[model samples]
Structures are given as structure tokens and as C-alpha cells.
Target: MNRSETFMEPENFVTFELVVHGFLVLIIGTIGIIGNIFCLLVLCRPSMRNSINCLFIGLAFIDILLILSAFVMFSLPAFQVYVERKFMWNVIDVYQYTTPFVYPIAMITQTASVYMTLTIALERYLVVCLPLKSRSICTYGRAKRCVFTVIIFSTSYNVTRFLEYSFETFVIDEERGITVTFLQSTDLRENPLYISIYINWLYMVFMCLVPFSVLFLVNLRIAWGIRQARMERSRISSSQRNEESLAIMLMVIVFIFIACNTPAMISNIMETFQIQAVKLTQISNLLIVFNSSISIFIYTTFSRKFRRILLQVWHRKRPEDDVLFRWKAEGGPNLTGNRSTRTISARRGARVLTATTSLEFQREISS
Candidate 1:
């Protein structure tokens, strides 16, 4: 199908799609931008700086870029088409030409995001499975280097996509005198066999399958490590426990990534096989965007320290509230439970003082 037809298809350009993709997508993209910014703000704090937080900060930055790209490339254009009867072909042309360049950027960000996740997983694995070495390997400096390396390699790998697409003018309707310029694949999309093999097999396997498998297995290993440590009564320090929690938080994000991207991959495979799954493809794209948008929420849900600190920084709570928050955090009295070590310590101290005073008085009388 041609770009015009694909964009303005009766099924594709229905009111529902206009409302969803045009309006709702912009909202989601905006929220994602803000959410990721908040993540950066929270994760970049001196107290929050760690190897995993470094990876998370990188992921958040990439997600922000991805959301911005989606807004410019997809959501804004769709909104323009929905609102303007006389759509500017020039704008669309620029969009078309911009896509090949943007395509590589998006892939670079996405691939880097995936690799960062893998890096986090590996860091977690080392921390849990090989605690002694983890301290040496999972330093913030090392994490920064890994993130830099991932970005460099991913960008290098996908830069070829920019050259693989170029714009060509195609006549949409001779009677109506409509000619539109749209992006066309140079050789890969033109050749059926090449497109099928590259997209269906190679791209799917490397991009989706390998990453998904690695994430799943690594998370399973983390879970097993946690269980084994508990069973063996191994002394996991507070920092190690925090690392495990962070891994669990990232595991949820990775699961969302798999869930969101799998449908898109499936649709790509079906399209390669000449199967009709346009709706599935559209829905999958939305889900992928959503996946990119919701990581901050997942972090908030899993990390109490994140939530507390975020609330403190964002809302600027009162000093009393801060004291209360710290008390609760330190296992003092809380709303859900009332057993407080502070109260126990206070009572124990008083009893000890009374017993010492009585013993001293009795010793003085006997002497």
C-alpha cells in the first residue's frame, strides 16, 4: 500500500484512530516525557547514584527521545491530518525524508535501551550470584562506560538503516491530480526474498528473540539466587538487598518491553508472510509507545525509597512529615503496623536504669 493510502485508509483513519492516535497519543507522549524527566531528576541525586541507577538514567533519557520522535513523526502528523482538510504535502514530505534519519535514531535508542537493561540484569546477576566480584565490577564508573559502549555499538549497528530508505514521488490519483512523496526502501523492502529473510528471520531473532530470552533467563537466575541466599542464611547486606529490589523493578520493565514488542514482531512476521494484520500492527505500535512511557510508574510502585524521596522532592513536605517519613522508613511506628523498636528500646533503657539504681542503693546500705 502507498503512504497516502496507508495513512488515510478508511479503516486506518477512522474517527477512533484519530481520537486514539492523534489526541491520546500526544497526551501519552507528553506524560512519558515528564515521567522520564522525573526519573532523571530522581535517579541523578547523589544518594541515588549507583550502577543500576546509571543504567536507569540512560534508559530514561532514551525513552524521552523516543517519545519526542513519536510525537513529531507519528502523532503530530496524524493530528494535522485529522484537523486540516488541506494537509500540507510539504510537511509530509519533510516527514518522509526525515524518517530514514529518525528511523536509525529510534533503533539506536531502542537497542541501547535493551542493552542497558541487559547490563542491569548482568550487574544484578553478579551482585547476587557472585557477591565478591560484584563490588569490583559493578561500579558507577564501569556502568557509565558500559552505557557509553552500548550507545556507540547500537548507533553504529543501525546507522545503515538511514541509507536504506529514500523518498520517491508517486501518483496517488491521476483524476484528482494528487502526487505525494513518501519514503521507500532502497533494496531491502523492494526485494521480496531479501525483505522476508531479513525482517522475518534475522531482525526478529536478533532484535526480539535474543534480548527476550536473555532477560527472562537472567531474571530467573536472580530469583533463584535470592531464594538460595535466604535458604542458606547468607548475610546479604542492605545494599545487596536494595540491588535485588532494583533488579525486580527492572525485571518488570523488561517484561513490559517483551509484551509490548512481541505483538509488533508477530505482526511483522505475518506481513512478511503476506498475512493481513494491519489492526494488530497499529495496536502493537501503541503498546510499544506505552511500554516506553510507563517505566517511571513501575519504579514508583516497587521502590518505597523512590516513592518517599520523590514525594519529598516533588511536593516539598513539611519537616514534621519528613521526620515521620524517616521514622517509618527506619522501621518505627507506621500506619499498617505499630510494633516499634524505638519504643522497645526506650522501655528497656528505663528498666535498666531503675534496676541499676536499686542495686547501688542496696549495696550502700549493706556497706
Candidate 2:
């Protein structure tokens, strides 16, 4: 759907794809909005307002916008196609109203989000392993600078994409029957210029393997540092345990990010090799929505704070599963029904205790 070959395949275009994407846009948009809003709340808290947390929170907001943009354009159109509702013309109108630019704003958003995530990982490694240096350097002022830099640099990527690709408008007249239009796509769609012979190598070197190597090394060093501290101390302080949990959580987050995005990246590389006709390009577009959607689960589902905020959002009104999760996270010392469990409450109480001294007393009583 995004290539520049100037070939038309209406037969290959499945209208049902529009329906699937419509659902996708709504679902992903909801996830992005809910998750990012929670992240923003957490980041705004004075205690949580640090460089690493700021980075992740900023990423969530970006994802929200990206998902929204996708919803406005791809998903809605796909859904319209499925319903045969002719609603895409309205979506195109919304697209014009909402989009900052006419060309691939989504591509830009995802690219920026990826680099921002890498920055977040780097900041996390620093904060966990080099607490002193991180304290000195990772201030609000420094974090703001990093965020600004990421925004500016990521925006520049769109320049190349727009310069390389453009769009066309088509009209279908009654006398002429049907008229078609062609649109040129982004520069990332092209083979590397100076290194065309080594397209895969260049992409792997600059975009994939190099960054992966650095992130893996940083993660390893942080893991090793945490282990050494544990061995030397023999007894872990609450602070030490906090550091370990954070490091582990952050590490898993980065690993999951890489895992979720790897298949799509490989698919992009394959595009440069075998220009196989786009079988399910719309499906791929929907996958992009899925890609952005899963970040919510990756960041929020595993953490106590995320659950707390989410529960707070639904305060005193929830279904069975949410009630279960809330019970599990809150140390419901006196859960009323099937939600009750000593082990579950103990674990949640420990979390609450770690977070608050008042809760610490509560946990002891519950125990």
C-alpha cells in the first residue's frame, strides 16, 4: 500500500481489511489513551518525576497520538470498507483536519518513539547501575533537554520521507467510468543510496544490530552490577531491592519492546529484497496499530503502580477479572469471595508496604 511502483490492484484490495482496521483503530486508540494518560499521571508525581520515568511517559503520549492518527486514517477506512458504508470519504476529511502533515506522520511517530525508547533504556541503565553519576546528570533540566533533542531529531526523519515520496488525487467521472490515482511513498522504502549493495548490512549496522548490541551490553552491565552488590552486601536493603526490581522491570520492558518490533523490522528489510506483491498490506497497517497497542500491557499490566492507577480510574466499579486484579494488587486482607487468598494478599501487602509505611503496618496486621 505504501510503495512507489505505480501499480493498481483493486482486486487485491480486500474491503474487509477496512472493517478490521476500523476495530483496530478504536481498540488501539483506547489502549494508547488510557495507558499514556496513566503514565502521564505517574510521571507528574514529584517522586516519580525522574529522567527514566519521564522518557517512558513521554513515549506513551507519543504512542497515543500515533494510535489516534492511525485510527483516523487507516483503521476507519478499513472498517468503512468492511461495512460498505462509504464512510472513508468522511475519514479522509478528518484526516486532513487532524494530521499535522499530509504524508506519513505515523511513520514519523513510530520512528521517534523507537529512538525515544532507546534513550529511555540508556537512562534506566544509568539510573540503576550508576546511581551517583545518574543523580548528578539525570536531573529535570537534563531530561527536558533529552526529550527536546529526541523530538527535534525524530522530526527530521520525516523530512527525508516527505522529500522522497508524494501523493496524487484521482477522480471518477460518469462519462469516463473510473479514474485512479498514484501516491509516492517515503525514502525508507528505497534501497540505501551509498550502500545499496549492502542494504541489509547497512540497516543491520546502523538501525538494528548496533543498537541491539549497545542495549544488550548496557543491560548486562546493569544486571552484573546488581548481582555484585547483592553478593557483597549479603543482606539487601529495601533500596537495594527497589533498585533490583526496577532494573529487572526496565530490562524486561526493553527486551519485550525489541521482541514485539523485530518481526515487523525484518518484514521491512525483506521488502528491499523481494518486492513481493503486498498480500496483506492493510493487515500490516493493522499490525502497526497492534504494535502500538501492546505497549500498554508491556508497561502497565506487570506493575503495581499501573494497576493502582487503573483501578483508581475504575474506582469501586469493576467486573470479575478487574476485581481479581485489584484484589491481587491491594492485599485485600478481607476479600469477600473467590477473590480472597492469603498468598495474594501477602504479596500485594508487601508491595504496598514497600511503597508506604502506613501500608507497611497494614501488611503486618494482615499477615
Candidate 3:
């Protein structure tokens, strides 16, 4: 078999690619963009402020860029064909011009997204398994630094991707007054040394193997920590329980990342072996798009606090309502329970005072 020979895909595969990469990506990407915007709004609120949520905000922003770039690179091309078939406006030329830039951005953001998830998992692992050290290690300053580092590394790693393609323009039909511009692969992209060292070995190790192995082990440790805490549930504090909840939520996110990313990882490995896996590659792209789009749903489903803040934002409710809601959620005084009204009011007042003090303490620590 010729290692460089193109594989001929079956007709069904074409249809599958068109539907999955075209319409499905369009729908999912649209929803993902809007959902991530909402996620940003919710995460940015004062009540949601924390190191983890700060990382989440960064992740959401990266996902937005990833989805948008995928839409332009993959979805718009599909639409371009559809427009040609229907003889519609040639707006698809937009993709032709934007792809060179968007392609590298997408690659950078996807790389950043993977590492950011890993960072979140590692942070959670520290918080859950080594609570004492996490106080100093997982501060907001460190989280921001981690994010900035990931962005820098991702961009630096993908700098070659930006240089891999060059754009050119030509007249296709002089009589019809038609011209087209498209990306052409540069020699660097075709160089065997570059391909072997950077594309195959470096990419597989850094993007695939390292992250997958670390996340798997860290998540297992986190699960063990949560289980140990649960066994001593009666002795655990409310804050500990909240930590477990957050850890579980992050575990779900990591699991989804592994699942969605496994196909792409497999495709990459197969390609490294000179195997033709075009269909798998297409499917992997769709899954990656889906992965980038699903975080908001995960956050809302796993976090009551997130949902409460979302509702508060939507309803424009008072800040006191949030404090009261949190107090109640933490097993505060029950206004309608068997307790007498005076006793309930007194307990409620005390709880409110405690909550206020805790909030102030958190503010001081955060500052």
C-alpha cells in the first residue's frame, strides 16, 4: 500500500460526513456559542467567583473560539456546496479567506482546552486529596497563571501550523469574471522531518498520551478521595461535601473529554501508521465539536449554585436571596418545621450572621 495514497471513501461515508459535519455541527455549534456565552456571564458573577470557576470561565471562552472556528472551517464549506447546488449567493467565499487564520486558532484553542481540562482535574485532585496544600497551591493567582501558561504553550506549539499553509488567488474563468482564492500547503507541511518529529511523535505524546494518562490516574485518585470522605460522612463538614460535589462534576467533564477525544487520538495514531482512516477522522472532528459545546449543560446539571445564579441573573433577584438560598441549602433553620416561631427566627438570624461572616472571610482570603 502506498503510504501517501488517498483513500476512496464510500458514498455513505460522504453522506455521513455531510450531515454530521455540516448540519449537526451548525446546530450544535450555534447552541454551544450561546450556551458558552451564558456560562461566561454566570461564571463571571461575584457569587461564582473562585479559582475553579475562573478556570471554567477560561475554558468556556476557549470553547467559544473552537466552535466558531469549526463552524467556519467545516460547516461553512458544507453550506458552500449547498449554495452552489441551489445557485444561491456565493457567501461561502468567506470561509476561503478566513480558513488560514481560523484553522490555526482552532488548533491552538483545542490544545488549550485539553490542557485546561487537565489543569482543572489536577487542581481538583489537589483540593480533594491534599486539602492542606491546595490552600496555597490552588489560589486564584496560580489558576490565572496556569491559564496564561496554557495559552502561551498552545500558541507556541501550533506556530508551525500557522506557517503550514499559504493563500493564493487565481482567475478560474476569465470570460465569466470568476476568480477564487484558496489555501495551499507550504513545503514545511510536507517535510518528512517536520512531519515525523512534530506531527507524529510530539503531538501524540503531548496532546494525547500525556493528558490521557495523567487525567486517568488523577481522576481515579479523586474518586478514591471522595469515597473515603463519604465513608466518614458524619464527621465531614459542609464545605467538604461541596468539595466532593465539585470534584464529581469535574470528573464528569474529564470523562466526557476522554470519550469525545478518544476517536481523534485513535485516528491520529492510525494515520501515524500509514492507515487510511478518513471516516474516523471526520467522526472525530464532529465529536470534538460536540465536546467543546457541551460544557454549559454539564455545569448547569452538576451545580445547584450555578443554576441558582443563572436563575438569579435571569430574574434579577436581590443578593439577599442568594445568601438565603445558600443558607437553606446548607441545612439552615427550617421556617415551616416543627420548631416554634421564636426559636426558628432566632436560629435563622444566627445562621444569617454566620453566613455573612463566612462570606466576609472568603472575601478576605480571595483578596
Worst 10-residue lDDT window for candidate 3 reads 1-10
Give the lDDT of residue 3 in candidate 1. 17
CA lDDT of each candidate?
0.69, 0.59, 0.80
RMSD of each: 11.2, 9.4, 5.6
Candidate 1 C-alpha RMSD relative to the actual structure: 11.2
Query: Which window of 10 residues has the lowest lDDT sum in candidate 1?
Result: 358-367
The estimated TM-scores of all candidates read 0.75, 0.67, 0.83
**Per-residue lDDT of candidate 3, residues 1-367 (tens digit):** 0011111345455456568777998899899999999888878876666788889989999999999888877777665655554465656465557766888898899899999999999999999999999998988888899999999999999998888778878999999989987767789988999998988888899989999999999999999999888887768765776788889888999999999999989988998887887667877888888999998789788777677767777788864676766666666665675569758666777777687647633531012
- Sort the candidates on TM-score, descending order: 3, 1, 2
Candidate 3 lDDT (Cα, 0 to 1): 0.80
- TM-score quality measure for candidate 1: 0.75
Which portions of model 1 show Cα errors greater than 4 Å?
1-5, 11-13, 84-94, 168-184, 187-194, 234-237, 315-367
Model 3 misplacement above 4 A: 1-13, 85-95, 169-181, 318-321, 324-354, 357-367
Off by over 4 Å in 2: 1-20, 80-102, 165-206, 277-288, 299-302, 309-367
Better of 1 and 3 by lDDT: 3
